[model samples]
Target: MAAKTYSAQHFVECDQCEENPAQYFCKNCPGQLCKECKTEHKNRKITKNHEITELNTKNEAFFGPLFCTDHKTKQIQCFCVHCKIPLCTECIIESHNGHAIQKLTKAYKEIQDDLQKKKEKIEEDLLPKYAMLLKTENLKQSDFSKQAQEIEKEIKAHTRQLVRIVKQVGKNATEDFQAKLHKGLQRIVDSEVEIQRKIEKLKQTKDLLSAKIETKPTVSSFEPVNERLLDEFEKLPVLPKYHFSKFQPGKIESMIEKNFGKLPILKIDTAKPNEGDSDIDSQEEEVEEEESDSEVPYNLRLVQESRRF
Candidate 1:
């Protein structure tokens, strides 16, 4: 039933009682109080001096108005430009006498306008750019992964091809080595057979001379036979010479490059974009301009910043 007392707005429960619709706002305690709790709150020694006002009349408190801390009866009418604080009539006569003053309403309007413009800039300009950037980055990441997979497949295929080529090369080299070895061995074997035949012939001649000497043969006959054997021995063909196959190793690095091709190096671009082209910097500059032009006080700045989240 107490909610009917409030204007056309959401009903709020008293901060103290939590059961009744709030009808009053305590400036000093900064609490919402219902009509029933307001009397008790005022009776309390700690809250008795607090400035309490009807909720409907306290609308300006939610905006940018404040009662002076020095003179509790007077509302802030001016802003001390130098100190960047809300000023009451008493504040102007005291410490802020010579300080640059601006109307509190003007300052509040300027802060509100600046905040609105920043909000519009974020929504219209920065948010869309960031969203597009996010999309592009996601696509780029996917593309990079796809390209890497493709390159990996190619590398694997090349490696298999190189393996097959190397196997064939090794097989061919082995076959060639075997052929040359056989040829060298065959030459040595042929020379051995020829030398063995000549040895047998020389043995037969030696036996015949021994038998003729045993029968007391003349010296003239033996001399001719011995001379012939000596001539045959001297004329015997020199052992056939052969050079065997030997393997000469090549450079491994050169072989790898020649067979499989050089592996690609990983390159990364870590260089940042131009400062002027940076969106973050541009947004920061805009925020700085908003702060400078509005000359928002600390509390108002806090309020503006809280709205961003």
Candidate 2:
């Protein structure tokens, strides 16, 4: 069997021996060394107490800038809490003198804990409250839309009723004017008939008187005819003067328009905090009375106007 031969495949050769595979890395010396050379490197006065790590152990200190920029030879090992900056021994002593400082590892853990608490607050409390508010606002929006639709329906109904009322008023006015004109004209026609009868009697009387004067040629005949004429004239009826003023549509239109303009405003009536059932019932009764009173005019006026017409 062939003896196992040592080879440096993944790792480099020791910096001192250049023969054996490196087993440890010195952070202060900043180099890899074999076990034999590592012992020798540790015993040296200049390298003694230098931080050393195994080759397999991943150390971030060896991968990046460890020395402070201002103090070229000093390592950056501490974090300044007050200034919120990384610092070395010299930086702490000079610029960040007496400032609250901790080891970088400890500071990093504390910062991570604080960030976790903030994340929990956002996820558990703040975000859920905002979500509830958003939900409430959405519900309010839906309610508002429903209310708007209801108001639109009410407005349409009121407009239709107003139009009906205006039409009825116009029809009533026309019928009333026609009725009054018919009544007046009838009275005039009756008076004219009576006057015509009287005129016929007067014509007969004049013819009789003219015949008497031609036959008798006496003043006594004149006296009898004159008396008859005077009596007939007294019995005759004087013709009546009938006058019908033109219907003023503007006045009726304005009145109907004013009534329509008084339509109630639509609104949401919130329940009173202290109101009881009795109060609510009273309010309902008042509303009923108002509605009944409002309808009275339409009923009574329409009936009365129809009768008059």
TM-score of each: 0.40, 0.36
lDDT of each: 0.50, 0.49
Clashing pairs in 1: none
For model 1, what is the C-alpha lDDT against the true structure? 0.50
Give the clash count for model 1: 0
Error of 1 at 267 (Å): 3.6
Per-residue lDDT tens digits for candidate 2, residues 69-112, read 67888767777878766677889888999898876655544544
lDDT of 1 by residue, 93-157 (tens): 98889999876545545444444444454456444543443444455445544544554454454
Q: After superposition, how far is residue 16 of candidate 2 from its true place, in Å?
A: 28
- In candidate 2, how many Å is residue 80 off? 2.1
Evaluate residue 43 in candidate 1 and report its C-alpha lDDT on the 0 to 100 scale: 98
